[model samples]
Target: MLTVDEHGLTVSAPWRSSERRIVGVIRDAEDWVLKKLDVWNAFPARKQTWTQDDRIRYLGRDLSLELTQDTIASLATLRDGDRLQISLADPTHTDSVKAAVVKWYRRHALANFIDRIGALAPRLEVPVPRLFLSSARTRWGSCNARREVRLNWRLIQAAQPTIDYVVVHELAHLLEMNHSRRFWKIVASVAPHYREACAELNRMGLYYMDI
Candidate 1:
């Protein structure tokens, strides 16, 4: 389960386990969060180390990793690396705030993608599944059998070419679900520089969380 620190305004995810790992995030002078741990019920002791990389850390804790102060700084700095607007809606609870901010980003990103698809579909003679913002870790975007498309909201943080390439790729799949030669022909016709965008998008994972 997830819980926000009432006093510090921190986001926490706790698991049922013997070892406990707690993570925290400091949003600003007025806000900080201490997330609870969620894992198995038992664990052994372990050594701990610190780093400046701005990531979660775990020390002598069963979960093995917790969010560190440096990680919070990193998250704040990452809000708009690609020039997209940064907006976060945090709930009163700490854990809810993390979920809320993520959901807000995803919803808005999906809305923008859908709007763009509507504008481009008629001109290009290609249609795609309705785009939905989601926290899908395995893919930047997906096309289902029902002609529905799911896109990661984090795509908004990527470059424009990356976003466009994914959109075009998903749309092409609506015509041909498989990545066959015909599929490439359709995508290439719409986005001549898609290969470059795909390459960059593939690298974006290095910079973000599961979203």
Candidate 2:
């Protein structure tokens, strides 16, 4: 099997598979591999420094970071719908700033995910699952036999439509656990544009992992 991610392409083959056969397989899929690579290459560089005036993605929009010293507690807040004001004892400390911002993201992610799940679950005729935040680097969301749902907190950075696609996907799994045609049809019933959202999520997955 061949897979592509932020780190680029990887090939997993049986131990008995010859190197020549692997090469041939890669050659056969050259166009697809290059297209996937191009998607990653076209992404803008991720932020390296968490400092004042830095931009952070929130719900598909860019919010500028505004740092302030608070001596008492580290706090992060959204202001004017475009600025993220973060206050910490040491405003200049990048790690502290990042932590505060991440804390804020996780807190809001839970609320947002819960709301989406609640809103979409009834449409799918499933009870709202117990929601949890995930720090996973690869998966966006998952649903288990116990009806529990875990969504990557970083996905809070994606657009609402993309977020909805993941929610609908997991909820659909409550009815059809496998990715068979029936499962996809269930997802399509609620999120008709899921294919577009899935493509967008794939292209942006690596960028989200950088956070």
Top lDDT: which candidate number?
Answer: 2
Report, for all candidates in order, the number of backbone clashes.
Answer: 19, 0
- Whole-model Cα lDDT per candidate? 0.50, 0.86
Model 2 off-target regions past 4 Å? 1-45
Span of 10 residues, lowest total lDDT, candidate 2: 1-10
Q: What is the lDDT of residue 131 in candidate 1?
A: 67
Give stretches of model 1 more than 4 Å off. 1-97, 209-211
Looking at model 1, residue 132 earns an lDDT score of 76
Model 2, 4-79: lDDT tens digits are 7422476867779999999999999999999987886676757657899998888989999999998998889899
Clash number for model 2? 0
Against the true structure, what is every candidate's RMSD? 18.1, 4.4
